[model samples]
Target: MWTKEFFGTDVYHLVSAFVIYSMLGWLVESIYMSFCNRRLTNRGFAKSPFCPIYGFGAIIGYLILHPLDGHFFKLYLLGALMATVFEFLVGNLMLKLFGEIWWDYKDKPCNYKGIICLESTIAWGFYAVIIIVFLHSKIIGFIDSWSFSMGSRVCSLILAIVTIDYIIQLSKAFGIDIRERCADKYESFKARWY
Candidate 1:
């Protein structure tokens, strides 16, 4: 199957988890930003009710750090470290690609180039503990309750819609040739990373 070929076993479950966490992340970020700014703000890059970065972050935490599960201290510390690094990289990449930083911490204390701050990093640790310790089982149960066919169909539909929205929003936001920008940024990223 395409799922097995592209991803390892249980691809449906993983994708379901990613989609669920993404919508939740979008909700949380939207509410938080609205409250902070005293106005409603759509925090998602696309018009869809999704936050892909959050989905990826959660998946990375589950795959890489779940081994530390039960060890709260280890999970928190490592989750914090991993998430901070992820945030820093994503924040910088967004700036380089879009010429805009999605979130800035310039006014906040202990911020590194306004890309990440101590408070947010600490919060990520707590968020990690919550997701791993509390939400993991529920998510597994939810995914398993669905038949493979149903789960795959749902996830595919959601992902397809989100991808379309992302493409439209990308063009509207930058008003430039995305291919050119991507090529230039890819070269820059390659040079920097390599």
Candidate 2:
């Protein structure tokens, strides 16, 4: 079908993993933040309702921790360190590129450049154990059950939509407010009604 293998793994399955993990991560973050802030916040870099960081992190975690699936103690300890490094790098990269910090942990204890904190890193370890023990098998099986042809087609569709959303969000960063006109219209309509 498409060009070829995506870094050895089948492109379809890889993308499926991204979409699944991103969606689940987004849901969890949104729900958790809603309770913490007492308001809805769609936490992610993209306009679409998923965080690629979580997707990438989950994939990376799965790759590294899957082999140690039954060993919770080692898995948790190593996973925490790996995830902390990943989180720090991603945070720093985003800050440099966007001229904004997506998150700040400076207020928390044992933080580094507001990119990460001890508590969060330990929490990542807990998440790693859960993913390795509970989610990895189910997600892998679900993706494997899909025929490549069918799976690729579906992955292509979802990836296309996500790519477009990413482009739009990038444009917004460059003073291209694609959403401005629609938002203004909505405000006027609301004013007239209420």
Candidate 3:
């Protein structure tokens, strides 16, 4: 399986895959929302032009489903399961940490706690097959072909941008000045520990 190569070598490719998939995810979300709302909607949770959750989900699906690739239907089922679990965990974690929900599927059919639904899982299954069987191979090859120094520079730049975007978005989601909250938390921790 081409995925075997995905496991350990070439950290640059993994980083590239993560960033590329994130941007693609953002594009898909934006296009879908635009169609639904009849206007452009930047559906990204962060100020960055990418969606990390989708990128992580894509990697997870690829890793989980690649072994079962020869058996297409079974691979899809497992991929759906992995993606659903990943979605649910990220949703609940966001709700816990930020007091906000990125998405609510309550109005959707067969939704579970507004985190996931049968329809979405089915779609994820389809996406998983395409990603694992087709996209991963090509992306890995392309990234691997790049010079190590060049790949390192590009990937590092992307990582820095995403890190800054996450910090800003997290602060915004607090709905109050983040500096105040951080100061308060720091004081509390100091009082308890020192």
Candidate 4:
């Protein structure tokens, strides 16, 4: 009865929500990168509009705003916008403080002439927005109506494991034989694209 009253026994709503959120994350990241960070387009990081980081951020946002019921959609959008602002501010500040670019997007379409990448920043902002909106709207009750108690737990666990694995691989690549090779390849790749 509770499920019928809330989610209406249809998982499509959840699926659609995630899809839209992920798309928003991609759009926001792409737009920010294009307008704010010109170097990303010149590099190559913005080549693909679909980024794992943004998707992950969307999921995080969804979870945070899951309790808002009918207002979840509005909360999600607001959260996403808030996240965008945060990303913009934090990114510009970091670039101003640091002389070296930590992330490069030489292959993407950016408008800024610096060592700033807006992809990750967008993702971070998106996640932050979701959390803030969810907390503000109290949507956790609706989320509880779902059948899966372990859903969020399971997803978080998987994400952590995968992220750790990727980090380890990147570390090994940086330290091992692939370091120079990857760098060279990346350089060539940048040259080809930009």
The model with the greatest TM-score is 1
Cα RMSD for candidates in order = 8.5, 7.4, 5.5, 13.2
Q: Please give each candidate's TM-score.
A: 0.85, 0.82, 0.84, 0.31
Any idea what lDDT model 4 has?
Answer: 0.49
lDDT of 3 at 165: 82
lDDT of model 3, residue 87: 87
What are the per-model numbers of colliding residue pairs? 0, 0, 0, 18
Model 3 regions more than 4 Å off: 1-6, 175-194
lDDT of 4 by residue, 51-124 (tens): 44444455544555555545745654656565555445545665675433435545545524433345544544
Candidate structures ordered by TM-score, highest first: 1, 3, 2, 4
Model 1, residue 86: C-alpha shift (Å): 0.1
Displacement of residue 138 (Cα, Å) in model 2 is 0.7
Number of residue pairs clashing in candidate 1, backbone atoms closer than 3 angstroms, sequence gap of 3 or more or interchain: 0
lDDT of each: 0.88, 0.85, 0.82, 0.49
Pull out the clashing pairs in model 3: none
Per-residue lDDT of candidate 3, residues 97-140 (tens digit): 87767888898999998989998889888888889888889888
Error of 3 at 48 (Å): 1.5
